[model samples]
Target: MFSGLSAFPLTPMNESGIDEAAFVRLIERLADASVDSIGALGSTGSYAYLSRAERARVVKLAVEHAGNVPVIAGIGALRTSDVQALSDDAQKAGASAVLLAPMSYQQLSADEVFGLYETVTRSLSVPLCVYDNPGTTHFEFSSELYGRIAQLPNVRSIKIPGVPANPAAAKAHIESLRALIPSHVTLGVSGDASAAMGLNSGCEAWYSVIGGLFPKTALAITRAAQAGDMKAATRLSERLQPLWALFDQHGGSLRVVAAAAELQGVVEHPCLPLPLKALDGTGRQQLAVLLDELELA
Candidate 1:
């Protein structure tokens, strides 16, 4: 069921806590854009930074307001019990599925990774998507491990980081993933920059960052790629190049999204949680030029 474009919302924050009003508005905007799914507390949503109670609140709000779209709650945590508890909270909050990553304090083995999912699967009735973001988790999953996890009960999707930014390598990588996984499970690509290539190469979905803030544009590109109109998708991606450049230069998309959302007047604060500051003034100014070039300002 996790197919097409999935928008990973940046949890809109303010000093008082999650800006519920702003959060609601962002969700409604995504729904209006007709994104395929809404990931309420994905990485872009800063799942790691929020308290358990705060995460539950976000899931509840997302499911309540997501309309017909599926709300997939991010249930990843450092400990197994915490992940299971969060999974329960997500189910109780009426999320359609839980996105799980093998987040760990120390390096994890493939067996440990499998064990984590095995335990979570036993506890959760909702469908689970194995989130393979090695960049953040410091855990990696080979195609062999993916098949093993896919065999587990209720494990329905795998959201993996996109291939190397190079187009040919990305295409080959996606084809290999398609060849590895069973037809029952969907393979989604997470890196927003390579989403068009992945979609065109038969990956079922785009777990997107920009889509969270600019779902209309994201959906447009997705539709183009899915319709076999690479030219159209390329045009859209070109327009988005400057934004993606900042993501490459700044280490990741969180700070960039924070700035873009505020630049577009979508959120009250461009800030992230402590230790992860918003883009500095110079960075914001640079982003503003790019956003303006894209007509987002």
Candidate 2:
């Protein structure tokens, strides 16, 4: 049922801290744009930086603003108990599902991975979405492991990033998920720019960081592609090309999305933690150039 434009929102923060008003306004904008669902506290939300209480509050605000819409809360954590805590808070806040990435501590064997999943699954009271964000967590789950993990009662879906060593292997992994995994579990596609291509290749939804800043264009692209209208899809994708371009020329998803937030006037403070920097003057100017080229500045 998680099939369509999935928006990963940017967690709004100001001098005082998590800006609830800005956060709600951002969600409202996405809602007006007809985004299918929302994934909160993922990389786009700067999950690693937020405290436990702060993260819970953000999830609550997302659910409140989203109303009946499916708000998928992110539960990626270094510690297993922390994942459960996030999941619990998400459920309390009215989230529809919890997206869990693997432990970010160290490299884990397939055997150890399954054990970790089993532990979380046992305590999970809400639906679980496996987040295969290899870029950050360095843990790309194998298809052989997925077939087994998908059998968990709480396991509901997965969001796989497209950055695989062997690109075809990632596609092969997705194909295996379709074939071996149960039919009930949904599979969403990620990797910002090529989301449309993944949808055509059998992914159910397109999870996008660009969606937070430009939901209208993001959903437009997804909807157009879903309807098999390549021309319309191309048009919408072109509108979002600027955001992806910023991502390519900048740091990672947070900096890119934060830059879009600044450019779009969504947040007041887009600062990240130490070692993680926001888009600077030259970077901002470069992004502005891209936006100008797209006529969206």
Candidate 3:
């Protein structure tokens, strides 16, 4: 469950609330593509915006439709008590593991962050993935913090951010962190654009956003890296440079992927929650052209 491509699908929504049918379609799409795992409610799934009940439903639906593939549910919340409650919900829903990013409104100290993981891990029955997403949470983790949290009972994987672009640097970076955590804890890489480089550099898994919508394409890169065909992995990643550029142009991947999902008719137009708009006409048009050019349409 921890070592391969874990696809994080969008939790499509409508005026009537979650578009259950569409969400199911996305899950089945990932499952049919034989992704190693299904990550429900990561940042891409809009987990933080949804209510606890909504998150529970999303994980339940993911597990139900993911066939034999494991489901890793995101349970990040601002409060430790709430995180504990969310963790309970995920475990009850049959999540194979739970992903957690230390979300906060006020800045948290290193001790506070460690305390959060320590408190939550005690109550957790399923394995936990440390979600070190500094971009969204605005809380960067030090190597020492990672070592502390990873020592907790259920810590099975640490989802670190992107690796350095240079191959040697990327390898050294991963190796430095790898030495800090226990060998039982696998290191998974986020940051979709650098996924190929991270995997080729020795990371064990790719916690991917693009894989959610285009599992086969992402799986190709993962397979290449796993087979030690670094050239093939790099080539595949370079080929998707246009798509990566859209992620940067649009500020982040959530909106661009939402646009792609709409263009593909996999979800309704304007699928994101309020205050977060879909790509504008110009952005959508550019995305549509790229999708066709890249055969992703």
Candidate 4:
């Protein structure tokens, strides 16, 4: 479940709350494309903004529509107790695994972070993926912290933020982390722009954002890397540099992808939750042009 492409789909929403039909369409799209796993309620799914009940519903819907593909539900919350509760909800909803990031309002020490994982892992029946997303969580994990959390009972995968751009440095970075964790715990790479390089550098999986909406395009790069065709993987990823550029220009991928989903009619015009706006008119115009040029429209 941790290997290959784990596609994180947007939790499409409307004024009425979750757009069930649209969300189902997105799940079925990934399933039809044969993605390795479906990541529900991740950052892309707007998990943080949703209530516990909403997150539970999202995971349930994902598992129900994902067919045989495994569902990895994001169970991140600010409090350890809340995270534990969400973990319970994910297990009850039949999630194959749960992704937990150390989400916090105040900064957390390394010991506190380790304690969070240690406490949550104890009651978890399903495997857990260590979500080291420093960008959103605002808490970084050191190599020692990773080693400690990985020693817990359910730790199965560690989702690192991104790899270095240079191939040799990327390989060395992955190798260093590999040595810290148990051999059974797979290393998955996030950051869509560097996914090809990460995979080609020996990471076992790609926890992807773009893979959620355009599974075929993401799969092309994934398959090339898995097949030992490094050049092919790099070529495919480089072809999408324009899209990657949009992610950078717009601050992050959530808004850009939300805009793309709206443009493609996969969801409503403004799919993001309150307090977050969709791309501006100029950004949308630029995205629309690129989407057509890249045949992603």
Model 4 C-alpha lDDT versus the unseen true structure: 0.93
Evaluate all candidate structures by whole-model CA lDDT and list the values in order.
Answer: 0.87, 0.77, 0.93, 0.93
Steric clash pairs (candidate 3) = none
Candidate 4, TM-score vs. the true structure?
Answer: 0.98
| lDDT tens readout by residue for model 3, 1-297 | 999899999999865689999999999999999999999999999998999999999999999999999999999999999999999999999999999999999999999999999999998889999999998999999998999898999999999999999999999999998899999999999999999999999999999999999999999999999999999999999999998998988888999999899999999987999888778788889999988988751
Query: What's model 1's TM-score?
Result: 0.96
Error of 2 at 78 (Å): 1.5
Worst 10 residues of 3 by lDDT: 288-297
Model 2 ranges with Cα > 4 A deviation: 14-16, 163-173, 238-242, 295-297
Q: Tens digits of per-residue lDDT for model 1 on 1-297?
A: 488889988888755688888889889988888899999899889899899999999999999888998999999999999999999999999999999999998999999999999999987789999999987898889998998899888988999887666678877887787677778899898888878777777788889988888888899988898888977887887778878888988988988888888877888664577677667688999988888778641
lDDT of 2 at 150: 90
Model 3 alpha-carbon drift over 4 Å, by segment: none
Which regions in candidate 4 have their CA more than 4 angstroms from the true location? none
